[model samples]
Target: MEVAGPSFLLLILLLLAPLSVHSTPPPYLSPAIFAADYDDMLESFRIFVYGARRTFKFKSEAESLFLASLLGSPFVTENPSEAHLFFVPFDGDLSERSVARVVRDIRADLPYWNRTLGADHFYASCDGIGFGSDRNLLELKKNSVQLSCFPGSGGRFVPHKDVALLPAGVAPAGEGEPRGLSSNETIEHLAYARLGAIKDPGLVHRLGGDPGLLIESEPSDRETFERRLAMSEFCLFDYGGDVSWIGDAMRFGCVPVVITDRPIQDLPLIDVLRWQEMAVFVGSGGGAEGVKRALRGMARERVERMRGSCVAASRHFAWNRPPQPLDAFHMVVYQLWLRRHTIRYARRDWS
Candidate 1:
């Protein structure tokens, strides 16, 4: 599972569109795995979720089903997997050591009737389960898994290219927390500044323009942002000499002008967004100048169409089916559930 996440024009130079670069991946598709779609044998076991009082950050899908059953829940499209017990976040309604009891019973293999009664297991959450995650789990996860599919209406929360499909939770800023980089004071703002915006002549000589413009009233407002972005009739996403701010432009609805020298695999959402069709990604580094010219010469409708496609690209990632693999909370549930299976059936004793 993967997920990935922009830009300005100083015009005139826009007439020359920046050079093209490496290629990108295909469009995003939906996830195929689900409990409902599981085989009959795997759907028999009941799960007990211990997310009572919303005390824990993560819980299992099985538990959700169990709690719903306890409430005498009516049919959801009927014949949906009646996978016994499922727990949901109780929000102070259910309390005590209910979770401890469940973990104990599961570890004891209490539900496995001669190894035929225990149900096949599955767990989902933003968090990781340590049970089966023994091998890869040990590998340090250097990067955080960002669930960009659900932006939840946070102000200044620049959305990724595939956020359009998820239900937009209207929780206002600071009301609820999202798994994102914390901002103690300074914003770790990412930018795609062109050489034309710099101060020193040497900088302009080294990077893209006039040094004076960098000194003169810098363009930092929304208007300037939009203008620079709209400069070239067609944009080139110069992922540049580094990780380009392609995600930022998409947040603003500008078709990312991706020009990369490296494989687009380095970026997630590469599979879902159809980066090539929507972006002017240059495959050959030397051909960049030519591609920029072609981009600058492109018709207005083509550019706008690409912009629309960028937004359309967003429709792929939904809540359950996020743009990336998993969220922090879900990861936790998976880890715990695997632990249950291991201790109960696999006879693996982990401290």
Candidate 2:
């Protein structure tokens, strides 16, 4: 597994060549079983942020903009030489050519990209899998750490290498407080659910008569939505891998019932967070009826326990200004710290 010192540069070149693919999946280690020392991460980790200029074509760059603002933060270094990681910030829609141009710019203007062929770098995007069609973007996904909302191994995300990033504007800055029902509060509703608009019509038609569930398609204002979410015991989401809805549900003390066909790796923060404790999963194999059975079968005590865990775990999904301890921003950084050696192992010919 070790790369010889002399062949390191040659390996980097090989990784940089077009059509060169690293197919070996990274080693799998669950962070849930072990405790992460945020103190250690704070003391040892530093990142150098790339000041890439954006043309402001798209309005979906909030995540990148927020991280870009961290250039002067304690976790950031003025000198790239002393940094353990590099941050690439981009605004506007991502395309194959646009992605390639950004990397080309970095390789031409800086010396660091040559060091690891982008294995030591990372970026954030709220737009999930929309920019994944291009060859250059696929290469970037393989080598660079991609902080994205839709992280599925079958598509754009590489689990151990990439981190699940929270979408921008989901949780306001400095708003990490749990907003759901108290332990003693009377649980009035069983669940507040919304199947994605794209969900199968037959499935929705079948679940409409379930008395235990309140499935709403009517658009509600943010205030009303949160109000309803806070009252429910469980929040059902089939939003096609939108992490914001999951975060909102957890923020409101509603245990999530995620119904998806994607692999478990698609879930955000699965590397560190124990999702089974905080949320319920319903696979496509079981169909819509499986979702109902899973929710209805839970005992009151189990429901309460899961609800509490949702509140506790929601902090990791909240984005705070200046990056609060264990918050979403810090969690993403911690994931990077966990994969700091990605560069050294970048040359493995998993293909």
Candidate 3:
């Protein structure tokens, strides 16, 4: 999800040769997860999940699923000495002091911290609040992978060092099932929201007048929501924090249209996938006119190609139990694998 311009696509193309195969294959071969090599480290790479059991438990079912996926993976190790990486799982509800206490205890009890200065140690927490408050924890996190759904910028989330954790969502298709495009829905633009920024009178007055664009301020049931999204060629997503809709739109075969002024860094698969090829981006300041202009600019063939790409990429965003090859869980692991070289520990000290 690290934000870069079109040049990123070139980098992806160049690096495609090395990042195209998963560490573990066959019994768990998934192309989506198979893209970068960690210098064969993944073949023997092991992670030790430290911290108390209670500290790792999450209130959110989705967050808990992420932990379950990691614990069930083959790369986890029972002994710290066998680990290439360390994980301290903390939930969103835990306080800064609680997180700090866990890190302090781990530093004292484990030799790994002193050897690497905690560079190889990482943590996963869904919430961003209270993470920046602790100086010691902040310093440690800066050197390690801080996985989270909100990979917001500023402090601990250095794009090159951290990983963007996608929210847990239902898979678009079952294993071996065909991913069919939506044919019933015929709407061109479908948006359901109450945000004032999106509903600006001047902008809405322009785009709303068109029958092709539909914006409903009223809330709808899940069934209705899915139907609207499925029918539309483009689904409008606000610049708001919640990005659950991006996955939903892809699931239903609607190309995502992100409306934001700032550069987007935390978009799912931004590091691997060519987002400009799949999703439409419009500046918030451009108003509804911007949205209309973007849509107008796209030819029919181009829109279809984008939708095809969305369907192809949807499987990577899925949440599967037991963690399939390139499912959401593996994608998170892949992100970590991509950053393996960024945090290096002293070899002689560890040896």
Best by TM-score: 3
Q: How well is each residue in 1-351 modelled by candidate 3, as lDDT tens digits?
A: 121122433423433322111111111123334433422334556678875345366645556777787786777888876677888777667777777877778777877777766677777765543345576576566666777564354443565666767766454346323132434435545443333425355665676677777766644676676666566778776655345656666666678787777777776666667788678888988777777788778897777666666656666777787666556776677667666534455567665
What ranges in model 2 sit over 4 Å off? 1-36, 52-62, 126-139, 151-154, 173-176, 195-198, 218-223, 239-243, 342-351
Q: TM-score for all predictions?
A: 0.35, 0.76, 0.76
Report how far off residue 53 is in candidate 3 (Å): 4.2
Quantify all predictions' global Cα lDDT against the true fold: 0.31, 0.63, 0.62
How far does residue 74 in candidate 1 sit from its true spot (Å)? 19
Model 1 — which ten-residue stretch has the worst lDDT? 1-10
Give me the displacement of residue 7 in model 1, in angstroms.
35
Q: Model 2 over residues 1-351: C-alpha lDDT tens digits?
A: 121121334433432232201121111133222233444566667788887344333334446544644553577777776778888766547665777778778787877777767778887655434345555465466778877665333566666777766555457534435654655656667777665622666777767677766777743777777766777888876646434567777777788887777556756666666677778877766876787788889897767667666665666676666555556776677778877753443323321
Ranking, lDDT, top scorer first: 2, 3, 1
Give model 1's TM-score versus the native structure.
Answer: 0.35
| C-alpha lDDT (0 to 100) for residue 244 of candidate 2 | 50
